[model samples]
Target chain A: MSATCHPSDELLVAYGAGSLDEAASLLVATHLALCPRCRAEVGRIEAMGGAVIETLPPSDLGADALASVLARLDQLPGAPMPRSPVVAAPGLPSPLRDYLPASLEALPWKRLAAGIEQAILLQARGIRARLLRIGAGIVVPEHGHGGMELTMVLQGGFTDSGTGYARGDVAMADQQVVHSPAADGGETCLCLAVTHGPLKLTGLVGRLVNPFLDL
Target chain B: MPDKRLAVEPGPGAERFSDLLSAVAQYGDRQAFALLFQYYAPRLKTYMRKLGAEDAVAEELAQEAMLAVWRKAASFDPGRANAGTWIFAIARNLRIDMLRKEKRPEIDFDDPELVPDPAPRADEVMATQQSESRVRAAMSGLSAEQTEVVTLSFYEDTPHAEIAARLKIPLGTVKSRLRLAMKRIRSELGDDQP
Candidate 1:
């Protein structure tokens, strides 16, 4: 089935072009695993990418590159092994299964506010990957971003800047965007967020409390 | 929907590349691999440079990707993808992996996400194979402004904001142009068909 809310075309193009950051690529792949139409789209983009490479002029790889590769072929394993299919939990997407803890409830979550919790998974030079859980009916602090933020909803729904995002929807925000998100009252919301930089909390109260918010 | 002018005719080198991969897969033919290595290593290096890799890094990555092709040749299916497509996919993944490696702690190479997806359905594979030259033609047909952003995006790890800064265009403009360009390409390649 196609996802109701999908990643922007540019983002998918970047992913297919292999130019997106690793964290962002992971989320995109996870979404692709669930949505067959997007997978087809990315597949087309990748094929086009390969064709683009074919038209470029060649570069030199030095004298003994082939000889070296030939010499090593004898030392490696016999045949290429097929990749084992990932057996992920019910709600967990295949791409994310390896990085996350066994189950969502088992995650080492830290309370961020009265009804919000977060668990960081990976942190690189300028990027951070984490899971956020907001209890139903809770409103998150209004905030902007220092760079780009991609939040993919895993469960339930959240409304941000007048747009309602349900499960499998990704809300992409950047420096120009500032908004508060509130979890739908029907169920708790779970989101996987990959941010390139720190989020700048907005509003007077948000500014006063920004220093205390680690996320 | 097929464009007669955009149909790709497989040349001798393309056939040779495919046969060599099959030889490597079936018989562990070092000779076949050496031939592939000679042709692909240099091309891959050039490809890497086009994607913004510096000289040494591109050279290193090209070798690494070549070695991977040798080891994984058995996994390649001529029915699914051509030699150029298969090899370039390897190079692209390796480059992305290097980017990830530099930032995070060492990644588990065995991570399932890193694995290639199963061969696409037969109809989709046919569509992709047919669309190759058409996609090329569509890319050439893009507006210069659209081409600039698309090229930078395909070449570097620049985010939308950085692309905007480099081109001195608004971020919204960059996104809109890219979206329009992609839409056109998709239409040209017959990707809009159900």
Candidate 2:
């Protein structure tokens, strides 16, 4: 029940390992920003990481390495610099102004379903990303990954295969699974999706769009 | 037998504190910068090594992560996150940069090189292993459920309700187990707690 909204242990472990991608990383970052107990647990894992470092026999460091770093450090004159308030604290994310590439935020969103709209974010090097916003209660077409698909919930909640996902939950799918996803009727569901291949659409319309989507 | 994408992490988490430190270092804080540098160097080294960096490359990246710390200390915020997590994130980002260069095959989960890391040292892991042995020796002192609860909490960092669900026990039962386990570990570690 709670798990429908929570990330599993493996996901957290992947996050700790730094194996997650940027889009999903954003989702998790947003989640970790708000959850305190999880924060402490992550801190403990970090402490464990430190303890691991302690057990390793000291490997020899390069002669010039320490000196080089010290030199670079010395070159940095101590000065108070301009800071972003959001960057400094856990409040609102930085206004979408600073980071979003203009092309990404400015895309024309197309209605894909009732209360659901999607805009392609960017495509390069055989990877395509899209920003999808689903109003509460909107249900997306049932689909599965063609190769591999990584989905991160940025805001609101989405129910896929009857499982609900809120902000920070990452849903991963490969060719082996097929399921339809819907959002809860409570909030707007925002997600960043990264797809390397294509998505297999389960419905009739999906069959038509599938050809175009195959890139 | 493998899906094409290299996506492994299927959940949420991030490093706001480190982002701040990077921003702050961009500003200027001498004292804060030094403190940041001192903390992350070893981790950066460890991370670089995991990325298949020779010792030289690993050492350089370690210095780079710390240098960023020195330059960006002014931006460090006590509120967002402490120095350690912030720096750890910085080092991790640096590790990612090195890893992308390895061009390692995507599906080979066995690539020790691709083990995404918070940049922990192998020695440090060995210490935890030793502590695990000590903890095991100490565990005989508690009931079976107490051992399970302590392991899940300390190792998994699971939520109370979740732990209950995981163990197929009542929430209250899980709490009791935790309480007993803590009492035992405390008495065992007594002065070691300091």
Candidate 3:
């Protein structure tokens, strides 16, 4: 972030409030992972959300809400889908990874770079999310997004433009602009990326590979 | 207006999110997982709304997040962080993913001149603004530039990035100002402890 950033207090608020889209969510998380300053700001806003909740007037439940929940319990064991293998991060901005059906931390990850590796944990809706590892001094190509791409840095450091990112950071791209990310040396940059569509390569080779990468 | 969106009494089975997460992980019970979903879904919806996402989009994200919870139920560990903190981290990361990177400028990390002073300021305006009125007043204390970052982050629902493009101040500044404001507020609150 060069004096400015994509996530602001309001966005953090909305993020705390759950108004952001899935595509954008990844980007902010990537940024937050690296920038501790934003992380603190987000924490404050979340507190404000609690304050707002406290200030709100109370309303009664639907009488059978508890019973309904309890009744629904029995059917849960037979849920239509298999237990989804969600990756559980150790820190902030966590999502459904809370109920992951398996131990993702133990999975075998393939190296993409020195510190960058990826474990393709799950895929659905033409979107595939995998864990990425980026070691220090590593620079990814400066490229634009395709349709939607979600990335979360689990460890180490990476920076794009003027903003530096660290563990727990997430970034989302949506064919809006181009960026080249490089990891801070000596630190391992572990990330989780979800590609909603094929990636559109930039630069000359990007153009040539665009046909073959099929991403 | 915020109140209108939430359910009262938090419905039923009001247990801490951490509790439910622990139960599922240690016990391998699906019911524990269900309790966690019922506990968080509506609040998660409200959170999505605050992010300025459409209800459907928010709902979908929330569902996806929840589904992840279903799948990841076995890994909940209570020692590292509480359940709310952990889930919040996940949801927060998920939201961060949605923001797109605009035109990324080349960064010269070698030049110390380019980086904002990394010093953490303790007495920024946001800290002084403890009450609602104080908060509004504190906004006046910031330069219009700082105020914009604050407003966009706290109100506009735009991610930190769009704020950079809209203001052209650079993403680092946006993060720094926010950090300063939050630090100030924490100090202000801390001063009252005695």
Better of 1 and 3 by lDDT: 1
lDDT of 2 at A46: 39
TM-score of candidate 1 against the unseen true structure: 0.82
lDDT tens digits by residue: candidate 1, B79-188: 65667667877888888778445321222234543323344457445544534465567778889998788777767665677788888989889999988887777776
lDDT of 2 by residue, A32-89 (tens): 5434333333443333333333233345556665566656665666566433333321
Determine which window of 10 residues in candidate 2 chain A has minimal summed lDDT: A89-98
Task: Give per-candidate clash totals.
Answer: 0, 21, 102
Off by over 4 Å in 1: A78-88, A203-208, B1-23, B26-32, B51-54, B77-81, B99-131, B161-171
Q: What is candidate 2's CA lDDT for residue B134? A: 41
lDDT on C-alpha atoms for all candidate structures:
0.73, 0.51, 0.51
- What are the runs in model 2 whose C-alpha is more than 4 Å off? A1-4, A77-105, A108-115, A122-129, A135-137, A147-156, A166-174, A185-188, A194-197, B1-43, B74-87, B97-194
Model 1, A1-215: lDDT tens per residue?
24567788888888877767767877777677656556656766766666667666778766787777777777877654443335444666656675676566777898877798998877777788888999999999888899888988888889887888876778899789888899999889988889989998888988887788887
Most TM-score-accurate candidate: 1
Residue A137 lDDT (model 3) = 85
**Model 1 global lDDT (CA atoms, 0 to 1):** 0.73
Best prediction by lDDT: 1
**TM per prediction:** 0.82, 0.57, 0.42
* Worst ten in a row by lDDT for model 2 chain B: B102-111
Model 3 misplaced stretches (Cα beyond 4 Å): A1-7, A21-40, A54-117, A121-129, A135-138, A147-152, A162-164, A168-174, A184-188, A194-198, A211-215, B1-194
